[model samples]
Target: MEGHCLCGAVRFSAPDAKDIGVCHCGFCRRWGGGPLLATHCGTSVSFTGAERITVYASSGWAERAFCSQCGTHLYYRLLATGEYFIPAGTFESNDMVMTSQIYVDRKPDYYAFANETPMLTEQQVVEQYGFPPEDAKS
Candidate 1:
């Protein structure tokens, strides 16, 4: 799968088009400007316009990449897990099949999950993603 940043300055590819979902954490809200519609791929994901991709160390273990020109949040990387979580909206097609919403408990209180998708809480993240308790404290 391939996608580009809003300004078209940054582009990336995901070899396997699986493990996609929405994240509703506070950090995601701030970085993504909304719920982070993301998809997970291996570290094989590469950037084309590397110079335009700016990274922000969002946490001790995670860093987020964005388009420097347009400030479009592109993806989040978990160094330990070697996972690339790219924004779904950036992709050309929304053919993402599997999904598992993370940080459900911390989701915005104003909105609710109207869809029938499975939701994961902080503890679930710790268990499923191997994120430690401290890491899941968002």
Candidate 2:
């Protein structure tokens, strides 16, 4: 799958689309500049015009890459997962994307799920998705 930033300054491609996870945490909310909708692609995810992609250490264990030109919140890499969480909105076409929303309990109270997609709380994430709370400190 292929994706890019809003200004077309940064581009990336992923060989296979798997190991995807959706994050609804507060940091994700702030870093993404909105609700974060992401998918975990491999480290092989290559970038074109790479210099335009600036990275910030969003957490102790992960970094977020964004388009410096347009401030487009692009993707994040979890050191433990060895996977890149690419924003679904950034993809050319998010046809094959399937997300299991995590951090539901911590999600903003203003919003409610209207879709049938499975929603997971923080504990559920730790238990089922191997997401350790310790690594999530922002």
Best by lDDT: 1
The window of 10 residues in a row where model 1 has the poorest summed lDDT is 129-138
How many pairs of residues collide in each model?
Answer: 0, 0
lDDT values of the candidates? 0.79, 0.76
The runs of at least 3 residues in candidate 2 whose Cα sits more than 4 Å from the true structure, single-residue gaps closed, are: 16-21, 134-138
What digit string (tens of lDDT, one per residue) describes model 1 on residues 82-117? Answer: 688888788877667646788888787777655668
Model 1, global lDDT: 0.79
Using TM-score as the measure, which candidate wins? Answer: 1
Tens digits of per-residue lDDT for model 2, 55-120: 898666888888889988878888777678788788887565455788887787777656567888
Model 1 TM: 0.86
Please give the distance, in angstroms, between residue 69's alpha carbon in candidate 2 and its true position after superposition: 0.8
- Candidate 2's clash total is 0
Models 1 onward score TM values of 0.86, 0.84
